[model samples]
Target: MGKTTNALENVFELAYNGKDYAGALGRVKAFHREVAESLAAGAGPYMMADVNEGFRDAFEALEAQLATVSALRDYDEQYDQVVSYGELLASAFVAHVLNDLRPTRWLDCRPLLRTDENWREGLVDWQATEESLRSEVLPRFQEVQTIVTQGFVGGTADGRTTTLGREGSDYTAAILAYCLRAESVTIWKDVAGLLNADPKTFPDTVRYPEISYRETIEMAYYGASVIHPKTLKPLADRNIPLRVKSFLDPAAEGTLIHDCQHPPLAPAFIRKTDQCLLSFSSKDFSFISEENLAVIFGALAQAKLKINVMQNSAISFSVCVDFSERRVHQLLDLLREQFTLHYNTGLTLFTIKNYDAASVARLTEGRRLLLEQRTRGTFQFVCQ
Candidate 1:
């Protein structure tokens, strides 16, 4: 939706950030049909569609499987294989559409972004990615012309397909800007741009037209959905600018994220709902010192448990974390010998970046705050 809007207004290149093969192809296919109809009816400007060939079978199977199981992991691998197909579908369709409008060259992105075989969460071997971009993709894109390519999908070492983490296409755009040294990377979204608060949650929300890279990173860390955490790293590393523009209004200025010294800005609000707060206390009445904490942290790392906040006293320690069933139970069992455990589920953690007294009140006004922490520029509260 965002991409099509921007493309009509002379914003040519687009990078998507989503699973390559997990969504309903029929819905997306239908969406493209609607776009085609709208253009034909003169109600919309001309735009293109890209669909990945890999997703067709997976989408069909997903419909059948939906009747039986709702578990995401049931078809994680298959879903990935299918979701990656969007890149292929999108790039090819865009190439054709643009050519119909005027002469253009479309590029396939698979051979461009080389990565390791971590499957759904494949890590980009930077040297490999850089070499390919410089040698293969960059040279092809030398002249100033519109180029369309898949974003979140890449090729593995053995020539098999792999995908970046879910919603990783944003990272792909940043990487491209870093490698090609583009003027800027713009992420076209459905919304106006980065808002002070989600309009759905807080009415009369304010749009932030400019934000420092550090502030953006902090917001992403606290669960802001506008940008991915990894997306900013490459752009920030190269001092490249990024913009989150509205696909609906391609000509709007949108929000710009760049380097600056932003003095404690607005009370950045974030809510992490559906969480588990876990506490571990020594069973033998031993002090939970640095060594003990270190060991426990290592176990948490091995289990892939992400800790959002932690507090420790002499003999007991507590941490708020996300619930990933695959490893949390195992970690609890392993820690049983050294510590007693307690936890609370169905909790929401609210974080305020660059907080003030009034900002805090506006967020937790009527809600009960169970755990509260205040830092120089941040405040956090856990509530039911």
Candidate 2:
């Protein structure tokens, strides 16, 4: 869930099972009013009245939805409906504020970006989306100097809300840039730039001034938290450069990712926590053959489980994947008919790109290593 959705859920919790919905509703209205007042104080009132009316309508619509929902559960329909308000509220606030400075237009992106019915992690319909953008968004861009729209949210054909995935705002930006044929896409972050390791986790992290798209994609694949994993493909395919800039110090050069060579660099450290290690063996005490591997991989794809690291012997095959109880159970149910399964949860998968012996030792020094795999350029460890 997005930050705004989490906050709204907290508000709902405080409201005592919707008995005090007015309190939460009043808070939202007051916040919108405060933002409008702050913007109106500096600029002349050209569209303030209209923007305020729009905000009121939006809030009322949200309130009506909240009144209808009795409880919050894990169902996809209710989950998507509740969490999508985060982006909507954020875009609305930004649009109203920007309109005060100049003639800016607020665009609801749900109508423009079309996707499948997968509510939580929607699959984009590229043909329908591109057509809608050409017909609907391009004309508005020509008319207005600035347009604000919600990210991470799209609409199905029948007009139901859906989200791309968690932390998908970067993917949303990339999608817009690809459709617009943009010169470049800049993602603003709190850090100075893309660092070799997460500064919060490791000390003395070094920032990369520039990196190639392939290297960036590899880093993202290994669980780099700085950029969303799905964000690099579209930009790379179109040969669009992506700049990671600091929002705090905007003047800094930050890091640029383009189609160019990356100089020899230090080892990059990536850590993915809360992992599960699953091992499979043939029930008849036979070798894990090609056919068995094919069935296992197919089931993994069906369950939407990504294997971060894997190793196989003549009799057993072990793999590390992100831990999700529901999905793990789903995968196990499908595989149990043929293979015996054993799993260990609460593990951490660490990856080092361009690693040396010293760096490898540093990571595994005091940890209980469960699995290890190494290649010419990369090394991975699953540790407890």
Candidate 3:
């Protein structure tokens, strides 16, 4: 859905921001036509029949709705345009899927998923979304039997578009399962299952046949790309299991996250690259205390910069976070006058869960560590 989502966002950008509805329509036609053409050339997803025929028909109808420039005069209307375009794309894709598997129904969660009240732009309103799912979606869900809704996209009370955070699809699944009180949630991936380390990064990666929710949450929090960070909480809250299975070998026994009795798991390695280590010290040469920490945390929350790994010394508090230029600059602006700051970019944060001395030594052997923190179950380090 990445490519599809990009196409939809491009349409929104060109039409709403650029104020070029005709150009937006042109891009929609171009990109979707290319997709349809590539599918004809046998380049797209596995389709049994000419799925493009259905998509093309539905997409043409969507194309017809793009020229409603007068309808997008206000902010709310502009948000509607963004969301409507996204829904139209979803509808078109669902129609395409319907062609592939006939007689199977598709459910659209319109009255859709939503965001929290204060930050209406894209942050999900978990309470409202789940509540709406029970009331508006459940009855429709029962009749449809199967659902294929778009992820990352939601709505607001004022009928405006909102998005969940990036890579929010897995979170979407978790939300749906929690609301529905589903038996289990299965996420089919390209790998065997949940691995102790990303196979691409570590050739000796070990798969977890069974993992606990607590362990899985720690892994995801430490920057495991296999699942979204926010995904496990909802599933864990209801004591629901999550399965990570390979799409290639669906029958193969895959990793399961649940409260089951299993042997001690292997050390899990999680690495986050493009990090920036921010160190702040008081100008007055004061020790790092509760008051100082509070000010730093407040600035971080305001800037929305998550500390991947953090440590404090007598005189300084240091944090390693993802290097977002905009957010970092904003944080610097908020705290520059109060404290002296030093930051190093282009760093990597490596977290080893259930680690041993050997694993810690192996990672630190070649690199010069910028910061290191070791706890009972986890060890984290940042290095250039």
Candidate 4:
């Protein structure tokens, strides 16, 4: 849904900028129908009809909503509402395809995964979610050979749609695995398994046959693209193992992330692009004490700004965070009353885990570093 939403948002942006909404709507309708038809073409007659109806319902809902909109308003709210169609349409089509192979039931996950009112990044009410799953999802699992559900979406208590941030589907899978207490959760990817470096970015990538939960978490925290950062916590909490396997070659043994120590023998690289380095200085040139740090952190929390890396000096504190205009402005508004702020955008954060001197020199060779931090096992740099 995250990727789909991003693609659709480009269309939405065009419409908002005074491009013909009809053209965008037409494209959306055509894309939806095209996907549905392609799926239904291989299905049996009855199954094709069923799939068509499901797709029709999804299309109708989106069309009705889009028909009333002339421009983007309440960006996050509208984004949540509009983008959710992707999951609905996708799951419907997938369920039909799976049913053709075997008995399968389509499950709407909104009712089962209850969350707070946060639009783009909702906080889960775990107790409610667990209870709802136990009561709603468990019984259906017993009746059907397979239950197909959408990821990255949940419903608020007041029945509003909410998303769990971008690339949150992995977290969704982990949530289900944790609540269900499943033996293991396997994430099928294009690559064979977890790699020391992203294959596309760096050549000679080394795949990990096995990794510990702690190492995986560190990799994720350092902005690894292979897995969602939030995914490991729930699975780790329950001691549920996670497997990263290649969809192209399912027979091969993939990377296993379990409780035992199987640390990477080589440095693991992670790169986060399009970051913002926010510098906060005391208004009166006073020293940055613990109280100042607490206030800044509290404001960050209130604005839901995730700090990737931070450094503090006597009077100034600088932090690297993902660049989000709306949220950044919100944070600035909260802090402007007490602090002098400066920010540098279009920065990249690079991290190397289990780093050696050679790997550190290679990673930082040509980059102009804005900030650097090091620990016993890891090195991080904010660079232009």
Candidate 5:
């Protein structure tokens, strides 16, 4: 889990479950103290006074904010305003580390209204964000080579802090690159490069030396964990190449995603774990017509449930989504009156792009499949 999740879990364990907000805050304060102490053991040229001061300031501010809270959400905005504040505190620690290393300017992109959408998850407001960045952030880059800032967070014009969805740092980088019109954007990862399959799951995964933007998008959309389609969109639009480099081995060439052509190779294997397959049958023996589909889609949209894959028959429709207990139940509540519902949970959705018979067989060999769909270039199956 990421830092934001870890911090929230700490609060959730105490404040939500244990009903001890003071205990949670105490644990956080002690943790911050330990961190400051450990860093001081080897404070060479770095200003230990500044680090100590920064930590104390942040601790006091966070304690004051959390002191007023009972649960995560009392009377604030949606997406749990209190939790979002904790998220910002988590990200600010990263900025603190950067500032300690060098003369870096730290900023919260959220308060600047760098991205739009008041929801917890956000998308770029290109015109407004670009203007904001060009005015605020760009000038600082001219003064200093490196500036540290928050990712996964932006704000609406009203200054309600919003976030670019989870794992949104890449999207944040893309936004910065697009606004700055940089030469390229590179994401440093643990992996050697972009691979056809997750190395941990598949033993013999192969890396693509270079790939096109479209292929990257397809892989990301299906289940590939390398780069998100959201991150690629802005970069692709600008024709800016993205390099997936290895932080462990900087000498490695890694993979490059640019405007280039390459021969088709092995089928890419993507596995999305913890999926739910829901089948909706008409109360009457009616075909799953456009009207039925429209109703189903609208309900799903209203519930904020994204359909990963779907199929339709004469009298029923089936769709796959990430299994969230609350959201799934909410969707079912909305549609139960219209259609008979049956669902399978704890499933894995396996997608194979540019698939072949061998690849499909290897994945579905021993599994009891819930749903399967195939097309010319893609094959997908949901299995428990």
Candidate 6:
């Protein structure tokens, strides 16, 4: 997301999970109206949709081509075109607003984060990506500019639509900052900044003025909604600093994430509700060895089942995993031939980062805790 007109410096972007696209789009519209009004004093200057009428033809062509492809990888090009609609919408809207106020640039991010054909989670080939950004991207648009672009999406080597993982727009910003070596990257989120815990859950939560990148990564892993897990890896790899600030109050200095030596904050409580835990064992009491685990895990990977925790013994294997419609059913069908499978759904997974005795109690106090595991900085529990 960026400003509508040539006020080139007001670029606001957000990394959001498409899960809430409806709500997100509403936010986009509101922001566009605000930017439009700020720059031009009236909304008439901005065009609602700058698809240029050619958009329909382009979409139809892409759709026709997509209808013919069977393999998932084969649809990369078409996917890129389809998912990029949102970006085009943003850029188009912004450009329309700027048609009079100022000259604005609508940026396409695919050229910057080019990757191999992994489709949805396109594996970014960093060296090539860096070179492309430095050579083609940075030198051209590095100047102070108001650029409107899409996030959570990218293009592939063969020119296909490849989305970064869900909630990937943040990663997109980091990559952009790293490639351009921007002074800093600020993620304009709806909230004030990173809080010690979710304010809704922990009434006493306080915002951390600043936190190290390592801590942010940990929070992301524990299901902290503030930042996407994928968003941190690239920035951390390059040691680039990141800030999460509220779009409403752009002047307020929000939480800063970088390498620092401050004492780590208290354990952060994170809860992922509505999970499923499965327990399995061979009907004939067959030994569960490396080979058996390998076969099971192979199937799991093929189905894209993300396992959170696992514990196995000679006769039985018990594991905690996320609930995915495809993988869960596939795994059960496969295992039923050799083992008796039982699973419990509608369970809650609570993770306390940097756990202490008090933190553990606070998370599991009244819950029917099922499975608990604690380490120096983290404690995970399966609660019903």
- Identify the candidate with maximal lDDT: 4
Evaluated at residue 295, the lDDT of candidate 4 is 96
Q: State the weakest 10-residue window (summed lDDT) of model 2.
A: 9-18
lDDT by residue for model 1 (16-68), tens: 12222223434565665564444434222333222233234434543443333
Q: List the residue pairs that clash in candidate 6.
A: 5-98, 8-145, 8-146, 46-97, 76-160, 76-161, 77-160, 80-161, 354-377
lDDT of 4 by residue, 280-331 (tens): 9998999999999999999998787899999999999999999988789999
What lDDT would candidate 2 get against the real structure? 0.83
- Number of the top TM-score candidate: 4
- Candidate 4 lDDT for residue 178: 84
The lDDT values for all models are: 0.70, 0.83, 0.76, 0.86, 0.78, 0.68
TM-score of 5: 0.89
**Candidate 2 regions off by >4 Å?**
5-74
Better of 1 and 5 by TM-score: 5
Clashing pairs in 2: none
Candidate 1 global lDDT: 0.70
Under the 3 Å rule for N, CA and C atoms, how many clashes does model 4 have?
0
Superior by lDDT: candidate 4 or candidate 5: 4
lDDT of 3: 0.76
**Cα lDDT tens digits for candidate 3, 1-384:** 336556655565565555656665566567766665554464345552445665666567555545553434653334444444454455555555554555434445435676643231356677887888878766765565555676655667776555555566688788889987889999989999999998888999999989889889989989999998888999999998999999999999999999877778889999999999999999999999999999999999888788898898899999999897868999999999999999999999999999998998887898988899999989999999
In terms of TM-score, how similar is model 1 to the real structure? 0.77
Deviation of model 3 at 27, angstroms: 7.6
The reply for model 4, stretches above 4 Å from the true place, is 11-20, 67-74
Q: How high is each candidate's TM-score?
A: 0.77, 0.86, 0.81, 0.93, 0.89, 0.79
- Whichever of 1 and 2 has more TM-score, that candidate is 2
Higher-TM-score candidate of 2 and 5: 5
Question: Which lDDT value does model 3 have at 118?
Answer: 27
Error of 5 at 35 (Å): 3.9
